[model samples]
Target: MFFRFACLLLSMLLFSGVSRAEDPVREAQAVIANQLSAFASDDAETAYSFASPNIRSIYRSETQFLDMVRKNYPPVYKLGNYAFGRSKLVGGGELVLQEVLISGEEGQDWTAVYEMRLMDDGSYKVNGVRMKRNTTSEGI
Candidate 1:
């Protein structure tokens, strides 16, 4: 009876760890959704808040980052009807890979693959995003 009890306790511990790991993915999804909503509303300050510190540092200022986004990823600024698909844990829960699809103005569609990293701050942030322009390409 003691052995069975010990086994059950161990199982519970393992399950708890798995549940903790899953939190990162959920946090990442929320962050991404918030950013998308801000973009749709043209609230650059709100959208910039969702970016990782590393990203913010790279851009130096929120205004600069907003300008870059507006100039380079204009379609993203007008994003709508976004959806996340095919999320997978990468590197033992240290990272997550997610496929994002968004519709733009005038029936335009965009697809991107995002790599999100779990930061030490207990928040998940997008580390990289690769926009897929061609659907016919099999390999990159």
Candidate 2:
């Protein structure tokens, strides 16, 4: 009976750690999804809230950030549909590399790779994204 209890306790501990380890990836995905939803709704402030401190500093205001996205990342600003692709964790979970396959409202295909960082307060924020047009038949 003691051995069985010990084994059960050990399993519980191991499973709990596994869940904690997976939380960062799930949180990162949620942040990205929320930001995209905010963009879809034209909620500039909500979208900007997901950006890292570095990005916020550079853009200065939510409107400025939205304007930059509109002018430079048209596909992201006017997204039709998006699907998550590969993901990687780096620097002991301090950073996440997430690939997103995006279809623009105007039928253009693009690949957006996002870099998200863990903030000081234990929240994940999008540090940057690199958007590129899909040139090959394989698609993003």
Candidate 3:
């Protein structure tokens, strides 16, 4: 029994090699992309499913959440094209930022900071998202 257990452990460790950097980042990006796809399809219920438990609690209803998104994050609702920029570990969680280029505009750039957290089920969800655009600083 002891020998079998040791062999299993060794195999597990050896096969669980995720040393490359892009693996985790690519997984995270895929999650965000899928969730965003749900949004673009006007599937509010599906989009809400991707949100964290805390966010779901606050929003209460998918309709309310969709309304809020349409009102505040129109770019996200009507996305032209988006590209994943960078992702990093932050505060025991992961932060992934993406730039969404709005369509039908001469020059518009919007960057969204997506805060993701690992859940108890070993799945990641979006804790929150903050969007900002490019603008010159007048005076700070």
Kindly state the number of residue pairs that clash in model 1.
0
Q: Which stretches in model 2 have alpha-carbon errors above 4 Å? A: 1-21, 135-140
Q: Which of 1 and 2 is ahead in TM-score?
A: 2
Candidate 1 Cα misplacement greater than 4 A, ranges: 1-21, 134-140
Q: What's the distance in Å from true for residue 122, model 2?
A: 1.1
Model 2 worst lDDT run, 10 consecutive residues: 131-140
lDDT of each: 0.73, 0.88, 0.70
Pick the lDDT winner: 2
What is the C-alpha RMSD, rounded to one decimal, of candidate 3?
4.9
Clashing pairs in 2: none
Residue lDDT tens for model 3, 20-61: 232555656677888889888999988888888988889999
- Ordered list by lDDT, greatest first: 2, 1, 3
Task: Report the C-alpha lDDT of model 1 over 68-94, residue by residue, as the tens digit.
Answer: 777877666667677776677867667
* True-structure lDDT of candidate 1: 0.73
Better of 1 and 2 by lDDT: 2
* Candidate 3, residue 139: how far the Cα is off, in Å: 21
